[model samples]
Target: MQFFASLVRSVYAATILATTGYAPSFSGDTKHNAVGAAKAIESFHPESSFETFDVNGIDHPLSDRPEFSLEDAAVSFVQSRLNITSDAVAFRTGYANDVIQHAYIHQQINGITVANAVANVAFNKKNRVVSFGSSFVQPSSVPSNTPSISVTDAIAKAESQLAGEYNGHPTTLEFVAKEDGSVALAHVVQIQDDDQDMWVEAFVDAHTGDIVHLTDFGAHASASPVYRALPLREQNVTQGFRTIKNPQNKAASPIGWHNNGVTKTNNTSGNNVITYVRGKGGARYTTPQSSAPLIFNYMQDPTKNPNATRANVHAARVNAFYVVNTMHDIFYLYGFTERASNFQNTNFGKGGWGNDRVEVSVQDTRGKNNAFFYTPPDGQHGYMKVYLFNRSVPMRDGALENDLVVHETTHGITNRMTGGGTARCLQTLESKGLGEGWSDAVAEWTEWTNATITDWVFCPYLKRGGFRIYPYSTNSTTDPLKYSSLKTLTEEHRIGAVWGNILHNVYAALVSKHGFSATAKTDPKTKGGNTVFLHLLIDALALQPCNPTFPQARAAWIQADANRYGGANKCTLWKAFASRGLGIGAANRVDSKKVPAGC
Candidate 1:
């Protein structure tokens, strides 16, 4: 529950003009419509929350910077439209420092800024307004010579071109409708190489209505070709050991929780990077490929061979493989089942239980941010390191360790997909709880598919685990806040267990009709297509900038969901769940207030 609180608080924003119950005072000569729009936003506070969507199991955070104001948008739109000089009326919002942020767009003639612009000028409550802050550029070009083209039509063309190149690269674009009912292209950005790249920045030629000088940047280099064949050392298993112990157990548990072996460096065509060597005994050690000869398990003992058939060893390899293959670009995994400090202290810095996965940094072997930990042992986050603990061995007649592997791997996949960020906040309580609930759902689904549990549902691992996140029963549907009081729970472990059960129910219902292979069309006209629901959840969580409450979380989810699945998507899931037994009302508990009126 405390963990849930951390998740919400860190992932999860005000108003004014309407406070007097009067329209904002403005110079009679200025455009009042823009002012009205800004006041409406200020009154409702549009940039308060965020959400996300997913593709498959990938995450994509939708950030809503509360700093945006109607004044900002107006100033920007005006600056670009009027081709105003560097110094204008000092268009700044009064509350710029409090809740508003200054947005700017620079006019680049070649590569440098020829002129900078400010946007969203409005008096704050104090009337001082943004006297000083970050500067934003307004469009300064008056494109009267260029032939006018509809922004919507241009965007459609761009989108069609981009479809062939997305290749898992996340992207974004800003579109505004023109007076002629055509779309105007503002800016296009794409997330590439773990950074944001601007593809285009322009203003519609006011006179000609044609696109002026649109630029594209930050396209990703094609992914390096994957070498599907095993490395040269696979056949050699001489580095086997009878039993292993952590020699550094009395000391720090070797950097990352997932660090399994020494850091190995290699170079083929002048390109080189450090790689991990997972040892047979589980104890981690450091080594460099350029300096030391590569050590294989078979090198240690000719008689003893590392057995991939063994559940523990197989699970370790699978985990290792996932780290190298899937998330290799992001992190350097060390031990499969690494441990840090025993408890939550400065020395340990909130490390998870011994069985959790540990992602360490290759650059700093002993730095604070070096190792990122994940726990829960059952959901998408839990699967991050489950293979290290269970080792995929069969304890019963019909048991397989792949369940745990898939479960933990799901977490890794989710984090990588979403870039592991947080979501926005909300006024409602249900959103925060659902955030946890979604993760639990991942765990429950993974477990059911990977492990051969009799019931194949959540909370089956505990005694009296009859579908309660604690004493609260989410199954009852009467209380959507079932897991909200996890902080006050007498016993917290049951919180995750219970939530997992509820999520399991959701998954079962979804799969029963859609089939496990069902895909989300992503086109609004289609039904039951959002194949990326799991990815959407993770992406939403990753985008959360601060801790999130259930209500806030619901808002973020709605935003992300609609952004990814469109407006009517809420019903797609609701109807599916109702048919599965969860009922439509409970399934549709997500918050819709934070989103715009229609979308």
Candidate 2:
């Protein structure tokens, strides 16, 4: 009865919108399918050179000849090959260089636009067409001008097709092309799960209520200790101390002794972060309001009694929040704005879409001995879950690990900034590995800034010294990740090692030239090598093209340096990249074993 009642309510709400008199329609008589489009492209010019690749089972023909205008070639090729109307495709986005001009075109049939059906056209420096690729649809026959069912009925049909508890809103009414080459008027509904963990856009046929298409937007995104510099204990804290006997050896493990000198409010909520106890029904737990600072018993098993583990975990949460907020603010100083895909709630309509919050889930997996970050699109909250380490050996809780927390938090930051605020852009093999590398670099930066530990290792407590393939050191023998190493490394983390090592060298070079200044950590204008490197790194992200390769990324850093210092650091930056086998003319083949020669 409740289910029916809820359905009735949803139907009523949806029906109310149909009363506004919005009806879907189609006007085009000619349709272009992939098969016809391919032929048309091949025959565009008999003298033009071309190549073909099978993308997602569709054979895409690309013209590499530089003899035609980009727009003219695209329009003429699609018109002659695909037979679509001239005005059907509209320009979406483009970027140009002396070597090539790339343009993205979107499809619009009648007046309504088709979602995700886009074509990419490229032109070379000679003003001639070079390449063309697209997933654009070619409809057989335009759908009827009118739909038999109302908008309310379409929404109900879409909801009916969903298996789990869901909430959705009708986003658009447009004609969508099916895989079978048929076109139909459909309702685009954005469906999100109750937990807000996953979301998808479903295209349901307005006339028959058949589900046509769906796009997934789900994005998925760490430590332990014995006594030495684990989690929040990376730095000594004199203000807040709570002593508890170690659970394994009954040795006293003092918690909450590592504070970064900045005082945080005892209230669970803050301007940018909110800390919650494990499994507290997502309720915010109150921090103890005392001058002596917050403390927890270290001997109690976090899984058995989360309350006993709260003081330390909470401290870790506070430290993580501080580190993330600091990184956010530091980047903000260098131009990472709300519109630039930053992680912050309540943007006040500044530059980015609002409602970006980072949810720090401490002790999330009980005794799972792992940690990870899950990033969603802008405006949606990002989730960081830190589990208690209990795999082969019962190690310290992950939340207490400073470098690990910073590492995981950087994942959220990088994912948001890259790909223009969507995690989808960094899905390439190299890009994905680079994301991990960026995280490690940032974690190392944070540790270096804090002057917490001398050894440049991650998760030192859990791994006795470090867990990475090599400690992030300047010594070439210790950190031997070359560009050629990517060929044998299929795992994301291992691939990341190559990138991380490269960045570590860059940091070392900068520090060696300009010298490290402790005050530069908070001040962007301090001119210290580390500060300059940080600023350059943040600026490079903004300058980086979508799904960038390592060479492109190297260029971005150089450009960032040029933009800030008028290319004063070009020689140093080039040396850093060249030393890592990412020098100019380095092949962008991650699957190749031959290493490029350094400059």
| Candidate achieving the largest TM-score | 2
Cα-lDDT of candidate 2: 0.59
lDDT of 2 by residue, 474-542 (tens): 676877778778878888888887888889888888888888778654456787788888888888887
Candidate 1 stretches greater than 4 Å from native? 1-315, 319-400, 403-439, 446-455, 458-493, 508-515, 518-532, 542-545, 572-599
Error of 2 at 315 (Å): 3.1
What do the candidate models score in CA lDDT, each in turn?
0.29, 0.59
Q: Model 2, residue 471: displacement in angstroms?
A: 1.3
Weakest 10 consecutive residues of candidate 2 by summed lDDT: 37-46
Model 2, residue 25: C-alpha shift (Å) = 58
Q: Give the TM-score of candidate 1.
A: 0.31
lDDT of 1 at 26: 17
Residue 171 of model 1, lDDT score = 28
What's the C-alpha lDDT at position 271 in model 2?
Answer: 36
Best by lDDT: 2
